[model samples]
Target: MNAEIIGVGSELLLGQIANTNAQYLSKQLAEIGINVYYHTVVGDNATRLKETIHTAQKRADLIIFTGGLGPTKDDLTKETISAVLDKPLVTDEEALQSIESYFKKVNRVMTPNNKKQALVMSGSTILHNNYGMAPGMAIKVSGIEYLLFPGPPKELYPMFENYAKDYLLSKLEIKERIESRVLRFFGIGESQLETEIEDLLEKQSNPTIAPLAGDGEVTLRLTAKHADSKQAKKLIDDVETEILQKVGPYFYGYNQTSLPEELMKHLINEEKTIASAESLTGGLFSERLTSISGAGAVLKGSIVCYHNDVKQHTLGVLNETLNNHGAISVQCAKEMAEQIRIKCCSDIGISFTGVAGPKVQEGKEVGTVFVGIAIEGKETVVHHLQLSGSRQAIRQRSVYYGCHYLLKQLKERD
Candidate 1:
């Protein structure tokens, strides 16, 4: 089914808030073989919303709406939809009870306007809102399906996942399974990755190849649809194998597996401990590593040597090295990594010393980076980089490169 996601909020048009609901819904719909043709954003005006709905109904079989479901008077999504569909707004008993129970549980006073959240379109299926007060609804009018959701992402995400997805699935006649696999890659440009798999991307049929580049990384989302689940997976695997054959060296991990997470996975699997000496990144590398669980088994500690004195006094980097090569030099980075590994008694040590943008340091231009890796019983190595961007961008990219370098070293060991 072709669908249109309508976001109802003047805040969205005024740039007060983002319409992330459309992005989430579009991805969800695609997984179910439903194509999202349009994303419409209309302010809280009933007349304009009615016009938008008319326009959507002309082109789409499904119209999903998000926002304007609150206690405020401006929250008129349901009222406008009910008017357009000629359906009366009726209070759902279960929804009303749920709203009341939520207020009671919080020991808060419920205003009269709050009851409006429990109202649903007449003859519509009630979708429970576990995260918020507003109960969403799914109603069919003139053969077009309308799905409503609350404004907050926390409310909309779970409501759609737990209730709306199953409801839509039940309405489908033939249930065709769609499988999607996202291959994450780093140290490769989107154009280069696409060129490697250009043939498959051009003549793609069963499993489609879609390349997206963002923040020094690229991802290829492969989606395959079939009646049988295993057959669909086989189709996806076949395409994946062909793509991997050409540009697999840059491939790091699968869907939703971040660089930090992938690095941690390898460290944990190999039973290796790590420590970090951060300079320009300012402990960001350590923060990324410690953010994921099971990091304790592999992470020993981190030393944020932002100041020259800290590098020399705390991590025991020689004052001679700092004065000679400077703190941003590859030599200093290598020494930092080796010293941290020795001090923390870890199997691996990583270091980040960089000149993030805005000013040149130590006669070095901005975006000059040095990432060093020191592994036990292995030669210490440093990767020199001349990057470009704002200070934050350079720092973030430095952290990503550090993770990628560590992953490469771990993979080499394996």
Candidate 2:
């Protein structure tokens, strides 16, 4: 069914808050093969909301709304919709009891206006709110279905997932399941990756392939639909296998898993401890790694040796090497990695030294980078990269490359 999302909040228009509810609902609707044609945002004005509803009613069969379900006077989402549908708003007994129970649990007296949170359109199917006072509703008027949800993400996400999802499924005549998988890749430009997989993109039908690029990484989302879920998954797997055959070298992890997460998982699984000596990246590599839980077990420590003297004094990098090759060289990077590994007594040492700027440094151009990796009982290796971007982008991409390189090393060891 075609759907239109109407977001009701002055905060959204004023840029005080994002309309994330529409994004969430659109994704949910897509999984059920519903097309979201338009997203309309209106402030707490009844006349404008009425006009918006009239326009949506002529185009869409399903109209979903978020926000304006609170105790305040501006909470007029239900009132406006009631006026448009010519339906009466009545207090839901179960919802009223839920609201009262919430106030009793908190040992606070329930205010009179709070009862407005329990009101729903007459003859509507009530959606229970497990997270907040405002229960949602779904009703049919003149062959059009209207779904209402509370604005807060915490309240709206659970209510839609627990109640509204099942209700929508029950209304569907055809039973179909959509299975989606995201393949994450690094060390490849988006255009190059797309060129390599052009054949797959062109002929895809059962499982559709869509490529997206962001933050020095590329992701391809593959979706397949079928009556049986297992069959749908198999279709996706078949397409994924074909795509991977061409570009598996750059591919790293799956849906919702990132380069840092993959690196941490590798370290934990292999029982290896690591340390880092940072230069231009300025501890970003260590920060990203430590953001994951249980990082302390695999991360011995890190040193932000931004200066040549600090690298020599703290991480034990040879002063002669720094003097001869300068800070942004492969020799300096190699010594920094090997020395930091020895100082921290870690199984692995990784170092990042780069010239991320608008100006050249020590005869090297901007975006010149050297990443060094040293593993116990293995020969030290350094990867030289000439990247392009702003200073912040260069620093962030260096951290991503470190994780990608570490994962590649761990996989090769196996």
The regions of model 1 sitting more than 4 angstroms off are 14-20, 93-111, 128-134, 153-158
Model 1 TM-score relative to the real fold: 0.91
Error of 1 at 248 (Å): 0.9
lDDT of 2 by residue, 219-284 (tens): 999989887889999999999999899999999989989899999998999999999999989999
| TM-score against native, each model | 0.91, 0.96
Which candidate number has the best TM-score? 2
The CA-based lDDT of model 2 is what?
0.92
Could you tell me how far off, in angstroms, the CA of residue 39 lies in candidate 1 after the best superposition? 2.1
> Ten residues in a row with the worst lDDT in model 1?
26-35
Once fitted onto the true fold, the runs of candidate 2 whose alpha carbons sit more than 4 angstroms away are: none
Query: For candidate 2, what's the RMSD?
Result: 1.6
The 0-to-1 C-alpha lDDT of every candidate, in the order given, reads 0.92, 0.92
